[model samples]
Target: MNKLLLFIIVFTLFSCDSKNIEQNREYNYPASKVWKHGVYSKYEARDLEGVFDGLEVDVIYSPEKNDIYVRRVVADTSKNLPLDEWLAMLKVPSKMSYWVDFKNLSKANAKQAMSIMINLLTID
Candidate 1:
């Protein structure tokens, strides 16, 4: 009975301490990080360089062409910019991080696409 009472007391004390910590903790809304979407062109990326913390660009792999193109739709082949060309136009590539929204990545082109991406990243 004594042991049971002592265990309960210790548990209660620890629980209360944790609750106090949680209650005293402060939170701030709307973090500092910002990300922008639909930045598929070099013009857009150049324009939004300092405006956003991160930029998301859509890319589709063309297995027949053996290259990656920046475009929202895979079917709309016109005005499609090659990934390398688009990346080459960035004024400050290191200023903001990029999030590639791969539109049609599959097992058939994953390896090639990764290779192209690696090459793109390595280009100085």
Candidate 2:
């Protein structure tokens, strides 16, 4: 009888611990998983840097420049920020990662875009 009681107590303790761990994991998930999309400007990124774990910006591949730029439309490429410049402005936390929403990432531009992105990232 004593052995059975001891076994029950240990089992109950272990079960409660596992349940609390699961709850903690779920509660902490959103803080790290939350993403802020359409963050195109420095002001927007600055405002949201603390509130979100990830900031996603729309980028278009500029064939003329053979580079990626942070902008929704290709028509106004003159005012659009270069992807590297946009990236440089972001003082992102170590927990955060770059999330570029490529508006015109095709097979033709993918290689060059990737290469450019790689260079930009490596420079940081």
Candidate 3:
């Protein structure tokens, strides 16, 4: 009958629409505007809490204390920023991506570094 044919056509159209929606459901993240910027570093005089799309830093781990330090070189203790304080200084912690360049990260300090990053950066 005409009613049966109409019902089948409507169901087919809805099924195709649903399939199209599913195919376009992929998430699109925002692209970075700035290539690179400094968040906190001794070399730059900018504020430590400045807003940036990404952070490029050199990290060094202290074996004795099991703590992480941010510095260009491991020997330069004076310019080092502790992991906790550094995270606290970020203007937008959640929105920023960190490019951590671990300096002299030995196998002994690898676990400690991972733990420090997880504890500080993990959003509850």
Candidate 4:
């Protein structure tokens, strides 16, 4: 009778431990993971292929042309693409987000900036 009781106790303890371990294993890792990645100045249109979850572009208002342009320097004038044209070059994914850093815009240009951004973002 004592041997049978001991066997039952051991079996109960082992079963309880197994259940605890199984519960802990379920919480060992997260259900989902997120990654943040992007590019800097002078990034090519083709550079945004399957690698990034975001894009950061520097936008400066061109008072001369009455438009917004993307570049680190307004005076460099080498290979900078206007904001609309640059955005047109890439087919942005629905999941990807954009960080538009507006540079050197006056209060009057703010409305234009907002309008341009709204129009750009609402495009299909």
Candidate 5:
């Protein structure tokens, strides 16, 4: 009986890992399980800096459940960043990630889908 109970507890602990989206692009996403999900599109892989900041996009892949995080870099530090430092951080592989927004989402369903993130990000 004790052995069975121990197994059950271990199973429960690992079962809860799930993915959630984060604002901005900073994330701890696992390697692509399916490469893409959600309302993603097939586009050329773009590996560039400054490009990631321009739009609110639906990522081709999202980080692990709630593991993704986005925070504002204190603007004052943006300019002082050394060229090498920035390149190292942003210079990742070029792969087909997605860029989506409510503008492209189906209008009939947009009203409901648009509010999905609001609920996720809400803290009461």
Candidate 6:
């Protein structure tokens, strides 16, 4: 009887702790796209355009004008280091990816759009 009781007690404590751990990670919203992806800034927007020199700007995804906006991840230049600087400092080689996949995508067009997106989106 004591052994059975102890087993139940241990199981209960383990289940309780696991429940709390899972609940702690539940957040109210989807993670920000800018925060999760797009490694560019507003300042970089104008400058980076030069990286993709001679690219056209057009939206592949659009339901509304205001609905579709440039998605970007920006460094708090004053506080956070610039993206290029961070890339330079990394001890190990790393890569960052930006995307431009809409409902209808042309590989060539998407490539160009991604270029514009990278150049235009800012931290604000």
TM-score of each: 0.69, 0.66, 0.61, 0.58, 0.20, 0.21
lDDT per residue as tens, model 4, 76-105: 577556777766656664445567787677
lDDT of candidate 2 over 1-124, digit per residue (tens):
9999999999987777543353334322345767888888877776776788788888898889888888898886565788777766667544456578888888988988888877876644
> Which candidate leads the pack in lDDT?
1
Q: Model 5, 12-122: lDDT tens per residue?
A: 988776664455978655344343222211122223332433222332111222211121232232233321222234334222232333332355545454454444333
Question: Using lDDT as the measure, what is the rank order of every candidate, best first?
Answer: 1, 2, 3, 4, 6, 5
Report how far residue 78 has shifted in candidate 3, in Å.
1.5
Show where candidate 6 strays beyond 4 Å: 1-101
Better of 2 and 5 by TM-score: 2
Q: Identify the superior model by TM-score, candidate 3 or candidate 6.
A: 3
Clashing pairs in 6: 42-122, 45-119
lDDT of 6 by residue, 1-124 (tens): 9999999999987777543454456534423333223433434434443343222221232222212233222222242433333233322212222343243345645655455446534322
Each model's lDDT comes to: 0.81, 0.75, 0.66, 0.64, 0.34, 0.37
List candidate 5 segments past 4 Å from native. 1-56, 59-104
Q: Which candidate has the top score in TM-score?
A: 1
| Residue pairs with backbone atoms closer than 3 Å in model 2 (clashes) | none
Please estimate how well model 4 matches the true structure, expressed as its whole-model Cα lDDT: 0.64
Residue 109 lDDT (model 1): 84
Model 6 residue 38 distance off true place after TM-score fit, in angstroms: 20
lDDT (0-100) at residue 105 of candidate 2?
86
Looking at model 2, residue 100 earns an lDDT score of 83
For candidate 1, write residues 54-107 as lDDT tens digits: 788899999889999999888977867998888788776755677898899999
lDDT of 3 by residue, 4-115 (tens): 9999999887777543454556643436655354434633312432444556777788887778877767678786677666766554567666677888787877877898
